[model samples]
Target: MRRLLILFAAAVAAPVLAADPAPEIRRAPVPPQALGVAHTLRTIPEACARLQGEFSGDAAAPYRFAVVRTSPGCRPRARLVDAAQARPSPASGWILNDLIRVPSAACATQQAVVRVWRQPAQVAPPALDPQGRARVYLEDSLQQARAGRLAPLPAYAVSLQVEGLPCPR
Candidate 1:
């Protein structure tokens, strides 16, 4: 009987003890935009050749525009081009909450930027539908703007990171 009671108590406390604390969200002021163009010519085909334009100091859009070589060889071919906006997640380490893509271009890769707003997760009562399912939260800034909510502007510390695939050929 004592063992059974101890097992029950442990089961009751386990979830509470294992619960993860809310993540710390950091925010930083946006950096001033600088205008300039820097060209990098790579000697090897393996190295990426970069043409960077404008500087905002933000990770998402470090430059207003940037053109990079898609592959080591200068071959014209179709390639998959994708960009994702991500945030740190305790369970998964990072979660890609938003994504965008650009159509395949020529040998010279076209540049893209994925801007994200980093803010503390808001705790609110779930909005349940008639069937009792929780409403889906909108993560897209454009959708939020269409709904009349002003999306937070991107800042230096708001976004965790912006990942992109090699330029499409």
Candidate 2:
């Protein structure tokens, strides 16, 4: 009886301890569809700050990134990119590339368009303020291209842009 009870408790606790912790939500990526933009999308400090405020006190808590298109006559669309994919260089703090699909439907089999966005100015905020507030600033630029031209897409790699913050808190 003792052995069986110990085995059951061990089994129950194993999964709980072994599970991977949720990722820290340092940056949010909003699709252009929501903001109505076909060309330009800027992830400025003010917008990101406002979006982060909605989350709980925990900075690690995951929250969706809110984005808005600044171009005229452009409809809002969503562009999602993970922080891990962002590449950093001396010239730029973080860089992201996105493949813009030609069709809105998931089932549509059409040639995909590629777009690249990068923050020219990447700067980290000063000291952690009294309210535990930290700031990260980034600028976005978009250009169109194609994926089928360069290299075959990776199996696990789907259509996602790059997102990053150099000095992530």
Candidate 3:
């Protein structure tokens, strides 16, 4: 009697305690089909401030990066990359060597295109303010990548090729 009640309560509480907590994701999501190539050349301080604004109060949030074509005339497409794949650009203060794959409906093959985006100025992320925070976020990203937990920040990875997801109205 009492033993059965205790067992039931323990069973109910076990899952609640063992389950992983929900990730803190941001609300302002980038448009799935972003309009154009990102040509903004911002200095580090400016970039840090914008990045802070982009992630709101949480500076550790994963940012939404896009690899759009430099030229216009085609339907704009943007694909999100995980922190694991976003290699820091040595030439510029940005992510580079990111592999962007354009999904081909009829085939399963993937091709890698190499491209680097260079901003016009030498402005760096702020030294002690948001810059420090950005550095911390990137470092955390590196740690998370090692642990295979990289995609939970900005939003769970979205695949345009998923069969059952409904189209946005």
Candidate 4:
């Protein structure tokens, strides 16, 4: 009886001991280079043209800034302004976290009024700061694209609505 009880206890304890600990979430600060890149992208003709095309058809279409590392050539400029970890206003559970640049015309000067939103849950908070989270999301998007998961937006994304400036006519 003693042997059986010990074995049972050990078995129960083993599972508990072996269980993996939850991953620690941390917020990483936005790198200064990211801001520099955003500024560079605004001046790049190729990037401006791409933005023009992206918003031409549907100005309100869901979109996120293309990661600079992944798209070295031409991509929209986006910067994380708010982290999902912060408490959202009571009016909405979603937080406007990103601002993407929209060109007034192909290769013309740009304006950043496009707002991107993500729920607290979507960001998997505490692990990364707003910019860090955005980077991860952009990287994941690249992977998904390579795998042929051609969805317009990541499922976790809440909204990519244009707030101020509309795409130039």
Model 3, 10-115: lDDT tens digits are: 5754574354232232123222222232322112221121111111111232123333333344432233344345543443344332222221122112111122
Ranking by lDDT: 4, 1, 2, 3
**Per-residue lDDT value at 125 in model 1:** 52
Mark the 10 consecutive residues where model 1 has the least summed lDDT. Answer: 101-110
Q: Kindly state the number of residue pairs that clash in model 3.
A: 3
Show where candidate 3 strays beyond 4 Å.
1-98, 112-114, 123-169
Q: Write the per-residue lDDT of candidate 4 for residues 16-127, one digit (tens) a residue.
A: 3354232122234222222113332222232222221133334454223442333556453332233334333325654444434343332122223333343443333235
lDDT of 1 by residue, 1-169 (tens): 5466445645754574354333333234222222343432111222233333343334445445444665566652222122234433435333332222221122112223232222233346557889999876567546867889753322111122222323221
The alpha-carbon deviation from the true structure for residue 155 of candidate 1, after best TM-score superposition, in angstroms, is 12
**Best model number under lDDT:** 4
**Candidate 2 TM-score over all chains jointly:** 0.19
lDDT of 2 by residue, 47-116 (tens): 1211111112123431223434344554323333333474422244333333232221211111122233
The local distance difference test score of each candidate is 0.35, 0.30, 0.30, 0.36
Candidate 2 Cα outliers beyond 4 Å, as residue runs: 1-94, 103-112, 128-169
Give model 3's TM-score versus the native structure: 0.18
Range of the 10 consecutive residues with the lowest summed lDDT in candidate 2: 46-55
- By TM-score, the better pick of 1 and 4 is 4
TM value for model 1: 0.19
Q: Tell me model 1's lDDT, rounded to 2 decimals.
A: 0.35
Clashing pairs in 3: 44-123, 44-124, 44-125
